[model samples]
Target chain A: MNTRYIFGIIITVVLLSVNQAFIQYWLAQKKHDANTINIAGKQRMLSQRINAEFYRLEKESASPHLLKKLVAEWKTSHFKLQSKDKSNKLVPITNSEIRLALKELNPNIEFIESQLNNIGKASLNLSLINQNQNSFLPKMDKIVKSLEKISDKKLQFIIKTEFFLFFMSLIILILEVVFIYIPIEKSLNLANAEISKKNEDLKQALTSIGKKNRELEQITYITSHDLQEPVRTINSLVNIFKIKYARDFDEEGIKMLRYLDTATVRMRDLIKDLLDYSIIGKKREKTKIDCAEILEIISKDLALKINETKAKITWGRLPKILGIEAEIRLLFQNLISNALKFQMKGHQPKIDIAAIEKKDFWLFTVSDNGIGIESKNVEKIFSIFHRIHSKDKFEGTGIGLAHCAKVVDIHGGAIWVESELGKGCTFFFTIKKDQNKIVGYEQQTELYITS
Target chain B: MNNKLNSILLVDDDEATNFIHQFVIQDHGACKHIVTKLDGQEAFDYLTTPNESGLPSPDIIFVDINMPKLDGWGFLEKYESEFGSNSSKIIVMLTTSLNKYDKERAESMNVISEFRNKPLSPEILDEIVEKYFTNKHMVQ
Candidate 1:
């Protein structure tokens, strides 16, 4: 719970407990007050009975022992009215009216007791005894009435306090419901609604992005495929025209035709490269690709080139990676061909390929003794159509490295080059071990974007 | 070099491509009679119908892979069901698609003689004719 809620609960519990304790104390005091009132009322009856017994001794010959017993009982009852308990110690009386009534009765009770002490003696004063008894009875009666009034007042106070405590507890409960509980519930509901709305929005955005990606892929494939036919036709017609009408064309016209043929050929290559680039990641299947075997195939394919250049291509033992075989083959083809193509003049190309196992992926390096790239242009080489050298020097559609980058990216890896001018270059790329877990382009895009 | 074919059929969706192939085949002296169709559907109809001369089917059929109506794969399936490998016609799968699956599929089919890329050249045409028709010409 939050700090505020915890504090609220603690305070509510403390207040209710304190109120309950006060009610309990007051109820115990109510019982003590009832006992004090009962003793005070009994003192009044004792005083009257003692006076009547004294009158019987004086006129109708009552027993002195009964009178003495009545006197003793009267004293004990009177003491108990003001005392704390049977110990007969005077309690601190809080009600001044009952205290004054008991104080006035004390002297009359003492005088009657003194007259009764000489009951069987000749020194007994009957008249004095009658007078003191008469005064003590009314005084004790006044004390009894005052005690009842105080008890009644105390009982009423206890009842009123109990009702107040109940009302306050109800108010606290209502306040907590209105201020704390209801608002917490409402905010919880609002937060839930907002979260669901955001989820819905994200879902819609993802579907739309998927749809747009599919549409763009279709457009790219269709446009490149359809454009190839016209370019091929142009190339073929130009060849036919040169053969059929060579006598009519001058030197300049022939040269112009040659330029047209070169342009058409370049356009065709660019379209083919674009189509190839767009087709990457279209098929999302991962299988065990033996890099060593793929290297063997590439070696066989480039055997003539290797012989012609007398280039020595060597590789360490390679590992099998989980990836699309075609994509991985294309990646290796581009990197190795690039290494061979950028060789220095009169220098035998020395290519070394090796794979190092990392924590989560295999890092492969293709190092070549070739005319390496400049440091500034290394990053730009992976972009589509971004060529560092002029078309006259390097013959390429400039899509090879871009294709390599896309393949590595879709396999959940990274590709980069470390090179210097006029020296050898090393192209490093990684293939994730868990390539089968890669779902598709959408997930791959999210992965790279986050990384 | 007496390895010229009697006839050749070009099945493709693009009219320009068909024209270029026709021009190239004629210029190479590979065939005297050349026939072209827009898609696999027209090629199927032509192969099934009886001609006026009642000559046998063309010696070679160059079929493009990607087409609007009834693609090369569809035509191949229909042709195998209809002819059942008894026919002597040579079928070449010709297309611009560099997809490896298409080449593999063509390689797996017994009816297909060869799979070649588009923009057929004179050198490639000569090689095909030499490889398949030269021995036949000697036997004849």
Candidate 2:
């Protein structure tokens, strides 16, 4: 089950337990009130019984022993009602009104006891009999009436208490439903609706972005293919002209033709590089690739340049990773070639390639002792066609490092450089251990460019 | 590089590319007869006509991929259907497309013997004639 439902159940159980405890306390109080009413009624009955015995003794003029026993019983009943001896007394009425009624009845009870005592002393005194028949019997009746009133009042108090408890229980139920349950349910529904709406918006944005990316790829592919034909035609015609009709042109005409030829070649390179940049992750073949093997191949490919420049290249142990072998080779080639191309005047280029095994990837570093880049141009170096040096100074299309950046990004990694102007530079890039964790080329390319 | 083939055909949409390629072929002197067609449709029509019309079927046909009337793939499809039995004539696909898919398709097709990038040179012409025509001629 969901946790929300479990939490709600827990809250409901707690509220119900609290309500049940309150009702139990009220019920216990009601039970005590009923016992108090019962005790007061019993006291009223005893007082009435005593009054009847007194009348009987006055009229019959016989059975003095029975009269004395009855008098003793009345006295005992009165003491029990008052409960002066708390330990031995049975009835313990703690209500203030009941105690007040008992106090008022105490004087009447004492007078009746004294009158009975007098009758016992003089068994045939007419005046004592008259006093008992008139004043004492009426006083006993008043005491019984007061006890009945106290019982009635207790019954009314119990009825009011029960009604109040029922009303309080209903209010508590409404409060729990209104304050806790309803608001929580309403907010939960609102949050669900909001999340679904945001999800839909995100889905639509992703779809549109994917469509735009595919369109851009198609446009790049077609433009590069179409653009190359004319460039090739111009280069071919110029070559034929330079070969077949070179003696027919003046010096200036020949120089202009050479310039045209150079421009056409550069344009072709630019178009080819653009196409390569666009198709970074279009189709990839992933295999277990050894960084050491790739570096060996790159060194062999650049052997002539290395010999001419007298550059020294060394490497430490490299880890075996999963990637597209050709792309990795290209990446290594570009960085090593850049190192060779950007050497300081009369300085033998020293390039070092190494890989460190990280938790999820291999961090590869290519350090070169060449003319390093300025700090501000570090980010700009990876942007397409962003050339910091003029073509005369540095013969490059400026897409080499950008292509390397794209390749690293396709492998779900980051690329950056730490360099100081006129000093040596080190370029660091990562390659994921698992090729299956590659990101989409379009998204990663955008991130690489922006970041 | 003695003349190895009787004739060769060049199919391309771009006039400049055809002109330069024809110049290279003529400069190499690899074949006595050379024909240029504006598109694949013109080349197809020229090839399918009766051989007795004083025009011999070229031993090699270089077909450009992007054309106005009929593209290289379209011509290849029609050419295979029309001339499937003519195994002696070789068809080579030529284009400036660097797309790997195009290369793979050209390699996979039975009618196409080779795929070449555009702007053919005299050395390439000489190589093609020596590789394909000279051996066959010597065998005959």
Candidate 3:
């Protein structure tokens, strides 16, 4: 995977973890808050009930039956308070489980209620205790005192449960902030670092390209202006020799003169080709290109050679792409001409063309059943002026493949040849899909200028 | 039309180029004397030799721009400052380059009569012969 994608994934995971932690912390806080409110509310209700019971006791002192009923009511209320509180009090660990445990205390609450009823029955025998008023008062006070004990116990339980919940919630919040949120920040910083490194690499590449551009400019100037002088000298000398020495020359000298003239013409053609190679595709431009049309154009351009060699060219499906059209055409022209040039002795010249699409890229193959190259010279073929065959054997500038390589490189692609001697040769190259939808195919780069 | 201009000088580094030019001058059958040098040094030395009698100094010197040791530009430098301006010789820049820089350098020297590209043709020789050898009549 690309480094950027990896960094993106890490940042995403960190953010998700942070989000999950925040949600969990919020839920924990909500649970703790609800429990505290429930506990406090339960305590307040029990306190209010006890206050009412005490006031009622002070008002009704003469009626034993009424006093007995009031005592029974207070006992029942106290038991209910203890039972409800045991269930609802701040369950620090698990409030729902505590609620279930409080159900188990129901029977205990009922037993306490029974004890209250008995207390009511005993209070009705106040005639025996009224002989000592203080004794009867103390008797009623004991019944009330038992109710207060239960209420106080429930209040203390709720206070402890609520305190524990608050502490646990604080711990969960701190853990979430430190472990989840902090790592997210760190991941983002790492992504920033990766981006910065890529940026620096890009800057260095551009600087190097700038230096290369200057060198290329100098080479172009020297080649166009300096090397040309010698060829012109040779041309003018040829003209002079023909004018001055034609009368003295024999048939051999005349033949030599023709060879000299032909050689000079060939040199001129080679120099022009080299100049085109370096100059074309230097400033890469994107444009819509139809491969079939470009091929037709090249065929038309090389019609004379094709007719001379009686070469048969066949093309497979060629998908149109966005590229520099002229350079692409030159690439095809060179490869096709090379195929035509290196033909088997007596076999009919035949070339096979094929292409396939692979995920936003196109692979093109130009194969010929001509003279195949050795494996060792595969890499050497693309180098400037490198020729497997000598000039005497074949007529070539030895720059066609070099020009094609340059053109493919400008498209952010690569061109390579696979071949075995006497078998055949196939040229492969890849062209990327240009999204900007431009159709610029200008070809005027000057890559080579020979003497 | 007989004038005091009877001699001509040719300066170039390449012996073959000088030989060809000398052949062309002889073929044209004009100037009484044609002094050839391998570089600008010999040409400058021959020019600065003080002459008491006004036997015409090389009436015109054709200097090739590219040379070893003393180039045409260097010869021009000595010709002006070391030798006085009132001399009889006229200088012409002969080079293989038609580059603007070479032309500009020649013009700035102030000693040059004209700039010409090399592999001098019969036409160029004729022009030179007519310009300096006033005594020579046109070939019929």
Candidate 4:
């Protein structure tokens, strides 16, 4: 769009300069033609002066010096006017009539010059000088008239050529505006309309997403409240029956009651974890959190389990990062707890936590010496409710890793695991340095609702 | 003992929850008379009008948040407008909602005395009575 205008202006400037140079050259030629005509006119007057002076010398007996000077002046001017040599002094003779006339005057000028050279020694021919001067005057007049006509023709040609060049430049300018500039403007308008239409579509999509998020939130609340209500009643009623009718129950009935108790306890824990996962990003604001401090708090919370397993926990210098405090704490807690829980039978657990500074974020790792997961099931660990071990072997709802995944995602990062069936596992995750770059679901929903 | 409450009101949409709460209150012997209503609207109507049994005004009203025909918040609004602020009656919000927003909402209102979870036990009822009422033995 911008280059078209620049190219059009450049072409116009080139055309104008070409016309200017041509016109200047022609004007300079016209000045030279006028100079030549002035000299031809002067030659005619000098011829008459020489003739009259000679007549005066014949009758009054004056010095021949004055007559000689006039002849000398007339000879030089005639030579300059009638010379056919192609040099600076040569005037262009275009008309054949003017050429023949200048040729006739040349001989007369030479005859007068030869007579003046024999000043006092020979008698001067006064009658012959008069006849030659008369002939020279008429031809010089015709030559001057011809030179004037030629100059006028040159001037007319220059004017007509200048008009033609100017008209051509105007046509080119109009064509440039019609083809280059107008079309560019039209395409720019079209692009602008397209961009605004896309913006409108994006706004509508954001609104619909906000509505969906709100509906999902409502469903979570309903599950937590309404669904848990009946479960709580059942659990409590069983407890009440157990307390009131313990003596009446046989061994088989007692076993069934204990099974019911276990099932209800597991169901409650499942519901609580599901609620916690769904409520991850309800707090949209982020704050600076010290990872070392959070790890210390988590280790203290798991002191009982750590003591029972005789575990050795150590960490390198951790960083202060921008994230939701609770979510980040939960992330570390889950990773550390998993490291403590999944262990090799009768083996001492050793866990290490460390962080490395990357270009745009901080990479963290939690490695543990435990009963490692199989390589095939490594990718499946972060999925909700995906457990590799049976319920009889491990006590877990398989939600901890999935919760860690959610936390990392909200912080604009990723989570993955590297493990083998017999070797220890290393869990890796990233946290962005700038919290504002995080486009978590909660932030987008809040923006749509508030705006 | 002055620790005993004169009259208590129990409001909930769930029949089992109200039954359990009423039984616990009765078992604790915390109050002289106990009134049970199906929902917040029925409880509000019962409190506003004179009863056939000629029961006294309740000292503590346990209102559940989620109910049909005027929920806990709606009933509170109507009660506040009718009785005005600084009423002597203690209003406790009882529900099964685990949402933090609901707890924050209950705390923000001045008319609500406390927020408690569902299935009120005998120990919880005894604590409420001991906290609000004067126990002459403790004073001695």
Output the number of the DockQ-best candidate: 2
Q: What is the Å distance of residue A60 in model 3 from its true position?
A: 44
The model with the greater DockQ, 3 or 4, is 4
The TM-score obtained for chain B by all candidates, in the order given, is 0.94, 0.91, 0.79, 0.88
Per-model i-RMS: 11.0, 9.9, 6.3, 8.4
For model 3, state the Cα shift of residue A113 in Å: 27
In model 1, state the lDDT of residue B30.
77
Name the lDDT value of residue B130 in candidate 1: 83
Candidate 4: which stretches are off by over 4 Å? Answer: A1-221, A440-451, B1-7, B26-33, B48-54, B81-85, B134-140
Q: Per-residue CA lDDT of candidate 4, range A1-451, in tens? A: 7788788878888988998899888877887888888888788788878888988888888878888777777777676665666575555665778778877777887788788877787998778878888887887888888788888988899889889988998899899889887888899999999999999999899989877876886677457545677877777777666776767999999899889988987887877788788778777779989999998899899999989999999998999999999999999999988888888777888999999999999999999988888888888999988888989888989999999998998899999999876678999999999877666254433211100
lDDT of 1 by residue, B1-140 (tens): 34378889999988888888898888888798999999889999988888787744899999988787888988988989988865688898887766676777889999999899888888889889888988888798
Model 2, DockQ value?
0.27
TM-score rank, highest first?
Answer: 2, 4, 1, 3
Tens digit of per-residue lDDT, candidate 3, span A283-391: 4566889999998888899899788878899997899988878888889989998998898656777888889998867899999989899999999999988888988
Model 2's TM-score against the true structure: 0.68
TM-score of each: 0.60, 0.68, 0.45, 0.62
lDDT of 3 by residue, B12-48 (tens): 8766666666666655655557888888788877776
Q: Cα miss at A294, model 1 (Å)? A: 2.6
TM-score of chain B of 2: 0.91
